[model samples]
Target: MGTYLITGIGRGIGQELTRILLSRGDRVIGTVRDPGQVPAEWEAFVKNGRLELLKLDVRDEASIADAASRVNEPVDVLINNAGIIGPDRQSTLNMDFEGFLDTLRVNTLGPLRVVQAFLPQLRRSPQAKIVTISSRMGSLSYAKSDRIAYRASKAAVNKVMQGLATDLAVDGIAAIAVHPGWVQTDMGGSGADISVQQSAAGLVKLVDRLTLKETGGFFDWQGDAIPF
Candidate 1:
């Protein structure tokens, strides 16, 4: 079984992804902003030694470095799943400048920080893969101005991961972005298109098939390629 390191596993898709990985007998190192607030179900996995929960705030570099130092094994897959939706005020007409900047910091720079901090562990793996959770709303090919802050952040991260894929090519590491479809989560809301289970399962399958040829590509949870 491979070792997977996933960020923001306190709830939503992150939590469900962690559950699926553990159920399949893979070791998972999941991050949460606050370990005390994690769901009770996660505790059983921790007790059984299948999961290791670490406290991390994706926007904080020190936290990322500290968490990376704690990992003893090579990481086969690194999922940059932690992200935030900008405030309701972030619109084209009346944008919240501070909130937009914060959104970029978390959604864009956060994943880069985590990947750099864990590069050593990832490089040690025989088949390393880096997956960043992006959004279809970020696609410039089909642009919409509703949530401009979030859209801009995801778009920027897609480019960042593409650059990472190129820079790490010599090391044989696959890096790509994935759009998790609108799942029913705190951010996706109650009327979202798909359930968390569907998205998580699809994402797992996509990650499983990732290869060097597919690096730098943006894809949906179902493994379909998405235009940048």
Candidate 2:
């Protein structure tokens, strides 16, 4: 029964998370690039007053501010889920510099933009929590060369969220980063290990159990603490 705001509900983990939240009677405010692109199942929830679908591109700060202004109710939870895999040509030797920058804009600064814009709504809620979807590839401990752009972006966001947690501590707001696992989605691909349902379900549980003590910690979908 909490008012949850999520970004990027067009497909993948975001869509599944919206479905699960709605099924449990929680009010969801979901964002998608195109409102027409939303699945039929999600549209049904919209008609029932359980879901509010907004057009938002996380990379655009103006659009995020507009979306936040439209939502009159306090946001109990804000999930920064929109992200991209970056250009395929991204590598250490030959990198698409522009694409790499765009990746960082979306994956790193985007969440911070949304958080700052929605601070008013978040403060209105007694149990405010901010969750950013980061990836294991971002971990500095994992020394992988592939997809350097994506990895760097995620790593930057992890640090950004950590700073946010520190600054928001006195306000009683919890902020944490979570890895949704390698789920079988358009981004995770067919060969991925887990399904959208499994990732989304575990993430919901993690969100429910989030506390001020765990803020700024990086964790997996199952709530296991991940080494930074």
Residue 91 Cα positional deviation in candidate 2, in Å, after optimal superposition? 0.6
Please provide, for model 2 over 1-228, each residue's C-alpha lDDT reduced to its tens digit, 9 standing for 90 to 100.
899999998899999999899999999999998998788767677888899998999888889889988988899999999999999899999999999999999999999999999999999999899999999999999999899999999999999999999999999999999999999999999999999999999999999999999999999999999988
Candidate 1 versus truth, CA RMSD in Å, comes to: 0.9
Error of 1 at 53 (Å): 0.8
Give model 2 RMSD, 1 decimal. 0.8
Which sections of candidate 1 miss by over 4 Å?
none
Off by over 4 Å in 2: none
TM-score of 1: 0.98
Q: Which lDDT values do the candidates have, in the order given?
A: 0.95, 0.94
Q: What is the lDDT of residue 4 in candidate 1?
A: 97
40-150 in candidate 1: lDDT tens per residue? Answer: 877788998899999999989999999999998899999999999997898899999999999999999999999999999999999899999999999999757999999
